[model samples]
Every structure is written in C-alpha cells, then in structure tokens.
Target: MKNFIIICFLLLVGHQTVNAQKALRVYVVRHAEKLTGDPKEKDPELSPEGSERAQALAKELKGQKIDSIFSTNYKRTKLTGFPLADKIGISIKTYNPDQTKALATQLIENAKGKNILIVGHSNTVLEIIEAFGGEKPVKPLTDDDYDYLFTVTVKGKKVEVKTSRYGASHHTEGGEAKAMKSNK
Candidate 1:
C-alpha cells in the first residue's frame, strides 16, 4: 500500500513536469530602413544602408536555429527578413499587418517548441510582444531606430521578455514615411 501511494505521488509530479515544460522562443524586430521615393510610391524597397544592415542581421542570427521567418506583406519587411531566411535556409512567410492578433495566436499555437523570427513595423512591434502575453510595455520606435531586437520566451504561464540591439543605426525624423517600407 505504501509503494502504491508513492507511485501515485511520482506520477502526479511527473505529469506536472510535463505540463510545465511547453516553451516557445520568438525573436522580433522592426524592418530596416527604406529608400525615399515618390509620393505615390507606397511600397519602397530598402535603402543601401538598410540592405547592409540586413546582411549584418543575418550574420548576427546565423548560429541560431531559426525554424521560421515571418514578415509583413510589404517590401521593406520582406527585405529585412530575406537575409535571415537565407542564412537559416527557410523561406520567408508573409503575414498581414492588419491581422496581428490572429498571426500572434497562430504562432503561439503552431509555433510552440520552435524558434521563430518576425519582422514588423515600429508601431506594430509592441503589439506582437503584448499579444504573446509578454511583460512590460514599450513605446513606438522612431524613423531612425532600426536596431531594436526583442526576444520573448514563453514557458507555461511565465513569459519573459528582453530587448537587444542589432546591426547599424539610421535615424530619421519629421513627416510620415512613404512606401510603407521602413515606416509603414
């Protein structure tokens, strides 16, 4: 009878351990800088500086096992994630910026136990972090703030968040960005 009770106790603890071990790691960043274009050029490509930064970002994440890369359906965001995707040997997947919550939910569900990278805009980066139940709130980034890299780890009920900078700096101010590239 004592052995039976001990066995049951062990089983309970084992079950708890299994349930507590679900984890996910996510790396997110705003897209790199974009070239200035005509007023009607709503989706501009990355500037030369932005391209160089993208290469640097790829170098920074080379050793990490990135299972997936997601970017908004815009030129700048796609351009930002392209190098990382190439380094990791994964195709870049596009997501709608308007449906951020849905995308966030999909990642938490389908991306559990995997390492994922998301390229977003400055205004939307904080929202994605929050959608994952991450702690702390962050203000929106500026035109020249291209180096913010956010890491979010989710383990069971605990969500840990950290910020680190990567690549070069290119700060711009005044007026809205055109092409929805760097600023959109």
Candidate 2:
C-alpha cells in the first residue's frame, strides 16, 4: 500500500509538471511610423526611423522560437513585422481587422505552446489583448504613442498581460525613438 501511494503521488506531480510546461507567448506591437506622403493613399510605407524600429523589434525577440507572425494587410504593418518573420523563417500571415476575434481564437488553438508576434495598428492592439484574456492598459492608442509592447503570457488557462517596450520610440527626435524603454 505504501509503494502504491508513492507511485500515485509521483504520477500526479508529473502530470502537473507537463501541463505547467505549456506556455504560450504573444508579443504584440503597433506598426512603425509611416512617411508623410500622398494624403489620398491609404497605405503608406514605413519611414526611415520605422525601418530602424523594425530592426529593433527583430533584435528584441531574436531567439524566442517565434512560430508564427501576423500583421494586418497593410504596408506599414507588414513592413514592421517583416524582419522578425524573415529572421525566424516564417511568413507574415495577414488578418483582416473585421475578423480579429476569430483570428485570436485561431491563434490560441493553433499556436499551442509557442511564441507568436502580432503587428497591428493603434486601434486594434487593445482589442487583440482583450481577446487573449488580457486587460488593456489604455482604451486606445493615440496617433503619437508608438512605444507600447503588450506581452501576453498564457500558461494553461491563466493569462497575464505585461506591458513592456522595445525598439526606438516614434515620439522622440532620436535616441531610441525617445523613451523607447519605458512602458508608456
């Protein structure tokens, strides 16, 4: 009886360990700054600083074993997510804004326990966080605020959203996009 009890305890502990090992990470950020040109054109390309910020994003998530990359079907967003996708050898999958809720479910179902990087616009970033059981720090991102990084971590059913920053800020004259390291 003693031996059987010990074996059962070991099995229960091992099962818990395996379940706890599954961690899903979602790194979400807004599209980089765009050039001021062609007011009529809906999709503007990234500015020079935006390109630098993209590289910084790639550097930030370098070896995270990022399995999936997602972006809205737009020039600035795609450009921002490209470097990391290229570095990780994954294609950038585009999701329409209208179907973000569905996409959010698909991401959780498909990614399982891997890392995912999502590039979106200022308006949609908060929605994406809410989709993953994360509370939004701000209701909406302002046009000038491009320095927020929403790091969503999922372990089993528990989800945590930690606000962080990466790359240069889009608000500064220079110097890492001005306060790039801050969570603002």
Candidate 3:
C-alpha cells in the first residue's frame, strides 16, 4: 500500500508538470504596407497591396486554431488583423500599442497554452517581441519592412522566437525571404 501511494503521487506530479510545459504559440506581425506620400493623413486605410497582404496573412494562418486575435486600435492594424479574425470567426480585440508591458503581462498570464495573433506597427513590433521575453530582430523594422512574421513560443518562462516572411518580397533584391530563430 505504501509503494502504491508513492507511485500514484509521482504520477500525479508528473502529469501536472507535463501540463505546465504546454507551449503557447504567438504569431506577431507588423501591419502590412501602408499608403505613403501623405503627410496630412494621420490614419490611412490599407493600400491595395496592403489589402492583398492582409488576405495572404489570413491564408497563412488559417486552420491553425488561433484562439484569439489582438490588434492595435488603428486603421492599419485593425485592417491587418480583420481578415484572419473573420476567417477564424473571432473578433479582433483592440489593444493600446503603447502599453507593451501590460499587454505582454496579460498575454503571459492568461494566454498560456493558446494561440494568439498580434498586429502591430514597425516601431512597436520589436518592443512587443521583447516585452513577451522573445528575441527581437537584430535590426529594427523599418517603414518599408512589412513582410516579416514573428512566431514566439512561450513555455512557462522559456521563450523561442522564429522570424520568417509571407506575401511579396519587400527586400531590395527580391530574393526568397530567410528565417531566423532564437531561444531564451
């Protein structure tokens, strides 16, 4: 009876440990290319190319079981995430772009073992990645860099970051996009 009790306790503890290690996958991306040459336009809707990119994003993530979608409250950001949200039958939840830490904390606390999508801007994408304890790109994303997709996996406090691209090539050379990975 004593041996059986110990074995049962060990099994229970092991099961809990496995549950705790379930990975939470987060897909983060900057809003697709926006209209340029407009100084007076404070918030512009996505351009034609941007619209296509948004659709591409939706196609890329479709059938991935995305539990939730979050986007900054901006015309571009919301539009970027809208296609995926509609395809997945989930509404896009707006979040303040400036509140990076708060968003990260909320995601880490409540979004464990779930898939999340975040649509942000060029300036904020790196900040969001770091806030989630994931690796940021070596070079800050420039205004013209719109095809990058950042996949961040969180298992407890451990983070793994993988960078890839989707849609049309934004690079000058027009070569195939490359991918990078980092673990923390």
Which has the greatest TM-score? 3
Tens digits of per-residue lDDT for model 1, 1-184: 9999999999999976765686788898889889887768889999998998888889888787889998999999999999988777789998887888898778776666778889998888988898889964456776667877899998876899998777764322332333334654
The residue-by-residue lDDT of candidate 2 on 10-96, one tens digit each, is 999997777566877999999988887788879999999889889999998997888888899999999999998888888999999
Ranking by TM-score: 3, 2, 1
Q: Which lDDT tens digits does candidate 3 get at residues 1-184?
A: 9999999999999977886788888899999878876979988889999999999999999977999998988899999999999988889999988787898888887777899999999888989889999877548877677888899998998999998888877564443333433565
Each model's lDDT: 0.82, 0.83, 0.86
The top-ranked prediction according to lDDT is 3
Lowest lDDT sum, 10 consecutive residues, model 1, at 171-180
lDDT of 3: 0.86
User: What CA root-mean-square deviation does each model show from the true structure?
Assistant: 6.1, 6.2, 7.3
Clashes of each: 3, 3, 0
For model 1 the local lDDT of residue 15 reads 72
Candidate 3 Cα outliers beyond 4 Å, as residue runs: 1-18, 172-184
Clashing pairs in 3: none
Using TM-score as the measure, name the better of candidate 1 and candidate 3.
3
